[model samples]
Target: MTDTGQPSTAIARAQDSTALACQRMGDGYPLVLLAGQANNHHWWDRVRADFHATHSTITFDMRGTGGSGKPQGPYSTKQFADDVVAVLDHLSIERADVYGTSMGGRVAQWVAARHPARVRRLVLGCTSPGGPHAVERDASVRRALAQADPEAARRALTDLMYTPAWLADHPGPYTTLGDPDMPAHARHGHLVASNGHDAWDALQGITAPTLLLHGDQDRLTPPDNLPLLAARIPRTTSHVFPGARHAYFEECRAEASALVSAFLDEGP
Candidate 1:
C-alpha cells in the first residue's frame, strides 16, 4: 500500500509507446480521477485528500499534457480511455471507480462503455455526451475558448469555471485552464479529441452504476447535458449544484465528495 500522506508517481506505457505519468496515494479500493481537457493530475489536488481516507486515489497526466509524452495529434476520447486502462494495467489494478470532470468525463463515458469490467462505478461532472444529441455551449463561450490572446482566454475560462464569491474567498491559482506551457500541437490535439467526442450510443453499453453531476449555472459544458447522460446511462443518479458553474466539483467540494464516496461505497 502507498503512503496515505504523500503520493507516489510512476510512468505507465501506452499501447503506442507513449508514456503516461501516474500518481497513487491512500489505501483501499482504487479510485481513478481523470482530469479535464488539457488538464493533468493536479486537477484533483483540492479534493483528492477527501477520498484518501477510504480510497486509493489514482491520478495521471493523459497523453499530451503534464509529464506525459506529447505525441502527434488527432487524439480521440476513445484513445484517452484506452490510456486510462493502460495505467490500471500498469498498477495491476483490475478494476476501479472512475471520476472524470469535463473532457475527462467524456473520456470516462468511453472507459465504462468499452471496458465495463474494469470500472466498478462511474462519476461524470460537467460533461456532454457529444454528437447531435448533446447540447452545445453558448456562442459567447465558444468565442472565448477560441480567443487568440492567452490572458484573455484564461480570464474567460476562470469566469466560466468559478463564481466571484468563491474566487474572493479562495484566491489562488487554479488549474481550470490547464498548463500554460502546453505544446501547441498537444493543445490542438486535446481540443480536437474533446470536440470530436460522441458517446451517445456507447453510453448504453456501460454496465457500471453511474452518477451524473453538474452545476446549474455551468456555461462551459452546460447543465442541459446532465439529464441527457442520465437518460442514456443505466443505473444512474444525478445531482445539480444549485449555484455552481463549470467546476462544481470544486465549488461544492464537501457535498460533492460525500455524494461520490457514498455512491462508490454502495453494494454492487
Candidate 2:
C-alpha cells in the first residue's frame, strides 16, 4: 500500500504485500467501496462522503490502478475479489458492507459468492450479470478505448454514462472526471477485468443481502439486467432510476446516496 499524503485518506496496510494497494476513509462499521476496473479510489468521493456522515468508508485503488501495484495480468474477477479480501485483512476488518460499480460489481459478486463471511452486505451499481449481451460495448466504442484514446472515448462513454438531459446541462463534470491521470495500468487492466469476465451462472452462489442499482438510460449495463441480477442472487433488492444513466451515482449523488444508505442500513 502507498500513501498519497491526502489528509482524510489513510493508506491501506495490506496483510499480503502482493495484493492491490488501497485507502481508507471515515471511522465506523467498515464500508468498502471498490472502484470500476479502470478507475481509482477517487471515483467514490461523493459516495464515501455521503456514508462518512454515518459510517466508516473504505475506498481502494484496485490492483494495477491508482496507487495499487500492476503485476502483469490477464486478471480474472475472482482475482479481483481476492484483492478485496487482502484489503479487509489489511484493515483487520472482519466483515464489511461492500459496494461496487460496473467491473467493480463483478468483483463484488465473486467476493459475496466465494467469501460469504467477508461481506456483510453487497451493493451493485450500473453492472451486468456477465453475459454475452448484458454489458457489451459497441465495437466503435470499444475501439476507442482499446486504442488508448480515453479523451476520444470520453465523449461517447460519458454520453452512455449520464442521461441526455443531464448530459446537456452537465457535460463538463464527466468530461473532466474521466480525464484522470490514469496510468497505463488503468487502460490495460480495465480491458482484462471487464471484457474477459463471464460469471452469469456463477451468481446464484452469492448469499449476501444485495442491492442492485441501475439506471434506465444506462447503455453500458442495461437496466433490463437489473431484474436478472435480483432474481439470481438469493436475497436481493433492486432500484432503477428513471431516465438516469450509467454514471447515475455521480450524476444523481443525493438520490443515489439515499438509496444506498437506506439499503445498507437494513438488517442482513
Candidate 3:
C-alpha cells in the first residue's frame, strides 16, 4: 500500500537481528524524519500528513524505540546516524532531506558530517550540538530521568517538553502518561546515548543546506543554545518561535512546517 509496494509499514535490518521499523508516505523527493528521544514514529503523525503531500516522507522508530530494533545502548549519536543510512540504503534512496528533533537532531548532524553526500538538506529542531560546549540539561531534569518510576519520569519530562499553556489545555493527552505504552529500555538507551553525545565538532563539515528551528521557551534545549548551532554550521539559518517549547512542531505545526516546507523547496 506504500511506495515500497509492501504494507503501509515495514521493518528493515541494519545489522544482525536489529530491525528498524518504518512507515512511508507520499512519493517524491525523500524526506527522512528522525524522532526525538523517548519518542517513536508517532511523534511526527500530525506533520507527516502535511509533508507527504509534497515530499515522500519516511518516519522510523530508531533502534531500541518504538517498533525498531532495541539493541543495548551506551549508544552514540553516530551509531543512530548509521541507522538512518541503513534505512535509506534498504529503501534504495540515494539521498534525502533529513529532519531531526532533539536527540534525533544530534543524529542528523552526524549524518550530515559522516554522509554528507546522502543528505540533500538538514533540519534541526529544538536540539543542540552537544559536548562540553552544548548547554547541559537542568539538574532537576536530569534527576527526573534517573527516577525509578517510569510514569513519573514521563510526566516530569512532559513538563519540560510542553509549555504550561499547552499542558493546561491538553489534560486528556497528558493524563495518559499514568499507564502509557513505551519501551523503558529504549527510552533509557536514548537517555544514555544523548548524555554521551556531543556532535559540536562535526558541524564544521556539514555541506547540506541547514535550518535550525528552536522553540523560544524550550526548557529541554533553550533559546540560549541556538548560538552554538548558528555559529558552528556554515550557511545555516534559524528561526525561533515565540512561546513555543521543546514540542515546537506540536505547538506550532502549521508555522513550523511551512517554514520547513519552504526551505526544502529551495533545495541545496
> Largest TM-score belongs to which candidate?
1
Q: Write the per-residue lDDT of candidate 2 for residues 1-268, one digit (tens) a residue.
A: 2223342444553334554667666656778887775777777754567876556777777766677766666667888888788778767889999998888898888888889999888999888778574646557656654456656666667667766687677645442233265566556766667777777788888878999998887777777778878878899888888888778897788898998888888845
Instruction: Quickly count the clashes in candidate 1.
Output: 0
Candidate 2: segments with Cα more than 4 A from true spot: 1-16, 133-135, 143-150, 167-186
Q: For residues 194-261, what per-residue lDDT tens digits would candidate 1 score against the true structure?
A: 99999999889999999999999999998999999999998899999999999998989999999999
Order of candidate numbers by lDDT, starting with the best: 1, 3, 2
Sorting all predicted structures by TM-score, with the top scorer first, yields 1, 3, 2
How far residue 94's Cα lies from its native spot in candidate 3, in Å, is 0.3
lDDT for every model? 0.92, 0.74, 0.81
lDDT of 2: 0.74
- Weakest 10 consecutive residues, lDDT, candidate 3? 172-181
Clashing pairs in 2: none
Please give the distance, in angstroms, between residue 98's alpha carbon in candidate 2 and its true position after superposition: 0.7
